[model samples]
Target: MALPIITGFDKGDTMKRILTSIFAFMLVLSLLTGCGKKPVIPDDDDDPIPTEFTAKVIGNTSGNLMNGGQYAEAGGWVYYSSETFDESTLTIATGLFKMKSDGSSLVKLADGAYRSINVVGDDLYALTQDGVFTMKIDGAAGRILPGISADPMGMILVLDETIVFLTQSGEIYRNSIDGKNPKELADVNAYGFYYQDGWLYYGINDASYTIRKVKMDGSSTTDVSTGGRDFVFADKRIYYRNMMDNANLYSMAMDGSDVKKISDVDVNSINTDGRKLIVSSFTGVRVLNFDGSDDTVLSDEYAVTLSIAGDFAYFVSQDFSPQHNKLSLSSGTLENILKVRRIDPQNDVVMGSGISDPYIVRMGDWIVYRDSGELTKGIYKVKTDKTSKTKLIDAYAHNLTLIGDWIYFVNDSLNNYLCRMKIDGSEKGVVIDLPVNDFVMKDGWIYYTDLNEIKIMRAKMDGTLISVIDDSDALGEIKLSQDFIYYQTIGMEAGNFGIHRIALDATRKFTYLDDSIQSFIVDTEWIYYTTKVSENELPMQIVRMNLDGSQSVVMDYFDEYVNVIGVGDGMLYFETWKNEAGSVNRMNPESGQRQLVFTSDLRNDHTVIFENNLITLKNNEDGSVNVYLSDLDGNNRLLIVE
Candidate 1:
């Protein structure tokens, strides 16, 4: 059982925090880390294996109490406990279960309020309503060790055959796996107690939460770091949240020397399988590689284990200074997902790629894409299972929004007018004979930013009954949510900037969130966004609000301004563009968890290579861009275009 808070915290309120953070977390389970600095492993791990959840990737046996020992792997099977709280009694309902390694053949082993589950040799050990309970792996011979009470926060820590533990009343000790021969380790009151590799790491129960460590036997107790939490040990490194650095995730040498930032989000609970790490924050539970790549939301709501099945890739990636430096922008070579010009009329810029235009969309196994390259400068649809590639339109298209049987897009080759074509390359015609900017389509209705009138316009599926929703301040990235249209009120000054939403039915219209809102995007559940901080210029906090514009929450913050690019592939993507040097952060829209995926440095040939669809942004002789969409193993050079 992963206690939501430090020992002194109320379990009831802690459970509430876990429930509230799910909204932002799942928004990314739909789409995608960085806490502060791009992950920098100075004494880097050697070699990157092909895939994840493998013995080679983790380089060990399957599973060991990650995520509060709610889950563990032993005897060729993975065991876990499912918990639910009953409000009447204010107690958790628990059930112990197991499954195959490949996520099949699930079976419930036992039923009880289980906590900090573990398995050793032929027996499975777990803390239940009564002391430590030992049961056979097949759910037989269950008995609790005598004399110990049913501590809800009891965690079984295995240290060289001797089980070490920290009590809820702030006492640390060593004992057997059978809960006998208790040897007191330390009498200090620790709030965040953790054990790894025979060492006990924790923080004092005070305002400082000063981090310290000791041996399992309570010897050599000394200060290791300052103001750290969520401590975990893996691969000769200690990872924790550095409160001094915006509460971003950081890792250091065992003796407390080489402290490097691992992630950007603040964490309350964490567990690592030596290779992949699981972290729980206000937003949601997240899974990422050691170097903080392939970071994605594992769940929307807080569970004992928000497990993400395999296909997670191995990561090999960076060194950097403590204070983050943002590269000033000029004319720099870069590759983006949906490359285009900035819609802000005041700025003349070819900004990083974003989803202001859906340059690519998938319908079933068919992929329809918009190309601006010289050779294939139009829209093309290809079938993944078959070799049927069709050039739907022989004209450049932007703002690609597929609605029903038609592809609604801005026809850049046709005076930048709004046009539509049948799903098959037939019945192509102009939908609206006006210049359009960013747009979205839904339920046979079209909403777009009309550059001609500088207004938010709407039209029917067949281009009839055109209407203007709002003609107020200039808008940026118009999105549809619930019954309202959420758009950005672009401005050069602080107060000028606001995210305004107008009801589609034209009944109500108002500015959303606050005036200091910088940039935002709306998903089905929440509006994920960023805001400018009063003290700092580099964009500050990433926040989210519900569709009705209530329950605004601050997800994560950065020392440097991070751009909210687009929401896709089960997560939101943010870009920290420092001139020619930039990195892309994948975020879980709900939980505010972030992981650095792609880093582009002009000096190197290719930078920060992760899993499948390796992103390579290279500059050509004529200041053009070339991107390679391939795999990390060099075997599948699948797709490449200029």
Candidate 2:
């Protein structure tokens, strides 16, 4: 049995305050009446005596509660477990809190690993790392039950005067609210459970992954004959997804009779109001009648964990923030109810090497980059002083470049387009309809390789007067310098890939620079390129030559594969890879002097340098990679995200 560990004010303090105020009022009134025959009444024009006003706490009667043990409402106040995601630890810190339905008078009850709170009459039962505990609704007199095992991932379900819950090892147990005569009802790896009448139905995680039911007296356990990932009990029927059959929704009676397929959509979760079923799928959310007919999609946004309350459906979006939203079933309207503010200190850092362009770029005081987070995989810009950050576009954007007031990028959507938007995230429009492989801006013209046509093309900033610059062979990476457009052409005929350059005006035809060129960058006077010494070896040499193919010289040689990232300030910044480990270094091409800037066990090929700041990806000890910033010489290191 549970015993009170912390005693509260024995219900006398509140009554005493009320009694004291009443006694004071009565004494003043009796004294006034006994001392004088009649007290002088104040005239209407005279000053009036002020009356005292006392504030009172009241319960809400309008707002509905979120459906779960993590959040419950009783007596007009909602108690919930609030969590904060810690990037450093990659975990959530949770605590118990309560607030009015109108989101007022918020109070924190306890701060620790507490969850699965259920309000039974005036007492609140919860599960913590220590054990199952019971407390008053006013957050006092907490005591851990004696015989209950501590299961942090367990849940508490109240049925009549008995409390049912699951242990961490998947054992089901039931006992009185005071924790007397505990009984182990079943032994199975159950992930979820629902209670109805005198029976408990739970979803098991064995080889069959089936749903089973058992009586309240812990006897006659039987399989429900339906397998699924998640099960919801409503309308006296079981609703679940058929994991063995394409993850479609199915429904049946309590006895597993008249089993029917509801829909062929891939359902993520299900919710119900006993009359209507709300289903969340890959496409969006759908509402169906009790018989799974007359289905209508409420919204096309990515929604998860559908919870229906009244005529509204609440869900969390599959976004970077996982924001909470409410949708009206009547009007098909959606509104964001709560926004999770994720202070991603490194949201501006780009950390993947698969992209061919610089994932992170700097323009003046603003840093622009592709957001690698699952929820916000688009182009974003943030101020260097950290004053503001805005998402310029809401798509998988890449190959970022800034030309004047407009920022150009490539969208990798189904219908892919060359996109441009203003620096302030305004005037967004498609520059061209074709998919761009890689692009660079020079002299008010955009040079790119068309993924669909496999040709090097040019177009004005507004997408006008488009023309192909080179179509002799398929183009790979494109670069621009002065009056020439330099690009790599695949070796289709001779099987020897080479670098080629053409004048911007088509006056000079395609001029071959070198064969077996892997990657290259061009400056005003010279072109720097990387080439494989042999057909089977990796890129090992940095060769520099004049624009007209004269004065060719080997600037540097490396045993490992090398890539040139950028060149400035009389130094060349590059990355080298010998195997799984790599390093970023800078060297003077003229002096042949090199200095190691940063070294890591993981690959650091996706890197960019701007304004004396070097940005690259760094792998953490916990198998997670984050973007980091350092000075040009590899000092002042700071993590962007983890």
Give a tens-digit lDDT track for model 2, residues 1-642: 000111111111111111111123433442343421121222442221111211121111101111234455667776665554332322234467777754578787776544456776777777654556677777788887665553444456655466667665567776555554466667776665666555677777666767788876677798887556567776777777787787788888888888889898877667775567878787898888877789999888666445444466656665422445668877888876432222222222211111135467776777777764446556777766554777776666668877666677776531246776677877666667566778877656677887756777887766777898877565577777767777777755653377777777755866555477777888778788888777768538998888888688898878898888778677888888887878888989888899998886536336777778877644344423355667888899776543
**C-alpha lDDT of candidate 1 relative to the true structure:** 0.54
TM-score of 2: 0.54
Q: Pick the candidate with the highest lDDT.
A: 2
Q: What local lDDT does model 2 show for residue 66? A: 13
Model 1 C-alpha lDDT per residue in residues 1-642, reported as the tens digit of each score: 222111222221211112212122422331221111111222543322211211111111212232345456655677766543222222224467777755478787886545456666667777654456778888889886543322334345543344444454556655544444455556666543555454566656555646787765456787887766556677778777676776677888877888887889776555565567766555655677778777776543232322222322111000110011111112111111111122122122222221224456556555566766555567777664435777787666767765556677877654466776677977666666666777866555677887756678887666677898788655567777656777775657553467888887666887665466666777777778887766468658787788777688777877766656555556776666545676667777657677776564544223222222334434455433344444332335444433
lDDT of each: 0.54, 0.62
Task: State, as a TM-score between 0 and 1, how close model 1 is to the true structure.
Answer: 0.39
Q: Which ten residues in a row have the lowest lDDT in candidate 1?
A: 315-324
- Total residue pair clashes for candidate 2: 2
* Clashes per candidate, residues 3 or more apart or on different chains: 27, 2
Candidate 1 root-mean-square deviation in Å:
25.0
